[model samples]
Target: MTDRSDAHTATTPLAGRRVLVTGGTTGIGRAIAVLLASEGAKVFVCGRDAQHLDDALARIREVGEGDGITIDLAEEENVARLFEAATGYLGGLDIAVVNAARGAEGLTDMSEADLRYTIGSNFTAYLLSAQHAAKAMGAHGENATGQGDIVLIGSMSAYVLGKESTVYAGIKYGIQGFAIALRRELGKKGVRVSLVEPGLTGSDMVEGTSEEQAERIDKEEMLRAEDIAVGVHYLLTQPRRAVVQQVTISPRMQDEE
Candidate 1:
């Protein structure tokens, strides 16, 4: 007879899982990294800011084991080194959160350099990191057993199509498409590709004081970065036989602008 303990597990556990979170030094990425680490995952993170990286690592170490580096994921060389460092630190990877991005400017206001950097950071980096992470997880290898999760942190901007977000919307629409197709492509191999679209959230990207942000959260006008982190954790803890393709989290009172 099968033991009752084995027959009825409430949820898949995250303990001892290996994870990488790019752009994890601040904001939503930082929250995700810290939350996962607190759950006992061995986390490796990267960010463009050295100070933020150090602070994030300190927070992670307080709860669980982790390491990190400072590097912009927009460059191919940096992305390569990031994975190498992650693998070396964690030994192997079971999950990756692709969340790094640059805020977009109006098309007419964007300079050539701004355009290039925004595209590279917001869109191209996601593709490149996904490529590396999939390969590392053996998604394409002969032994391609179902074995990994890739969560792309997209935005509700893809659907809202706000007036000031021409470039940002386009990139997010591209990510929405990429995530769905990638999931289908990798489904048979056991790698889950999911897109998480967050609504207005209080973070560095949003301009506000701590008190203002707190008020907005209280009013349900915005979400906390940690709220999205909880949503991500839900995605990662699903049963192996199941998959959550997408999650769109928005404040209860948020409306299209």
Candidate 2:
């Protein structure tokens, strides 16, 4: 066998790159994973649910090289383990997509446990995952076949807000800031960092949206998971000398105010 690592060297921008996508079982994460694989990336993905993991892997395999494991990124060790396992499967990762996140609505009505869970899932997981991804990317160096990239999936909610989006927005603002700082610190390593803040995207996160917002989605007024994936791919394909550090994607019909 020629091996999966050498598979994508032929044509497309993402050809032959090793990629890791968190929350790959559903939503924007799944969309990103499938797209990357189709572009010839050796992709490994993770989710908390076993069935979702299998399903996502099968879907990715339908179009490209893909593997999966069940993981809860809330735990720091699990984040590290994910990187380790992915490195083995993909022959070291060139891209890390931190798209796994949970939202907490109504900080006023939510319990302490709920607060912790959201923070862990949203903020802490992102930080730890980026830390581990950065380490893996740094290990490869600029000259390595797999160049480095960390793509953080943030929410436009960092600037826009809903009635109960306090917790969710808070977490996004923290991680978004973190990604920018990490990019600065890693400038010497040639690892690219990008932040994508999407608005009113359709996914499991939509389940938490207000009925008014859901109505818009039902009417095809919001961005689909795949739409966001396309944007991420566009960012990923940019020349090595360029990077789209941050961008916000939104549905045309939806009002941001």
Candidate 3:
């Protein structure tokens, strides 16, 4: 019989792996960073708020090892700097979670400035950051084999397409399409691309007091941010030969449109 014991295993271990999590100082992003750290991954995260960055890094350090910075990803130059800093800190990248985004109001209710910021931060940032992450992972380079992982954080807004969420839904729809194309573009180069869409998750993005959010979670009307984190973890920990192309996690009791 063949020496099957010496063969490579299907599961990708997280121990000592280098990870980059954008928008990781709050909500789903923060939860992902902490969970990866707990699993022995060396995490690097970024956020717009310095306080949140400190808090996240502290939590990660309490579990494993981590570092991070504060910067607004909407600016292209900042995105470049973020990758440079992240790779420098982690030595090299093995996984990247692109989760930085801002919620947008209704089109008619939004000011011109708000509209531009929403598009720039939510859509443009995701694109630019993913581009940099792919290059960092050596995608399209020779000798690539299971090079790395990229998980984009999308939203159920894409499918829901509810009123007052025009810009948000449009950006999420763009992300869904982008993930499909990106997986094909990078697959041959050994980079895996996946998307995780959360439905009605309780986070800073949602408008509610902590008590209200907790009540919603208790009622099963909304998902905890950690629920989305678990979905992200599932995508990252899969076997090398498989890629979970997309995962949509919705609250069981959430009324569907």
The lDDT values for all models are 0.91, 0.84, 0.92
Q: Per-residue lDDT tens digits of candidate 1, residues 134-229?
A: 888888665676589999999999999867799999999999999999998888988999899999999888879989999999999999999999
Runs off by more than 4 Å, candidate 1? 1-10, 141-143
Ten residues in sequence with the least summed lDDT for candidate 1? 2-11
Clashing residue pairs in candidate 2 are 8-15, 8-16
Can you write out model 2's per-residue Cα lDDT over 60-172, one digit (the tens) per residue?
99999999899888875888888889999988778999988886778998999889988888888888888788778763344433248889999999988777888898888
What C-alpha lDDT, on a 0 to 100 scale, does residue 53 get in candidate 2? 89
Sort by lDDT, best first. 3, 1, 2
lDDT value for model 3? 0.92
How accurate locally is residue 214 in candidate 2, as Cα lDDT from 0 to 100?
64
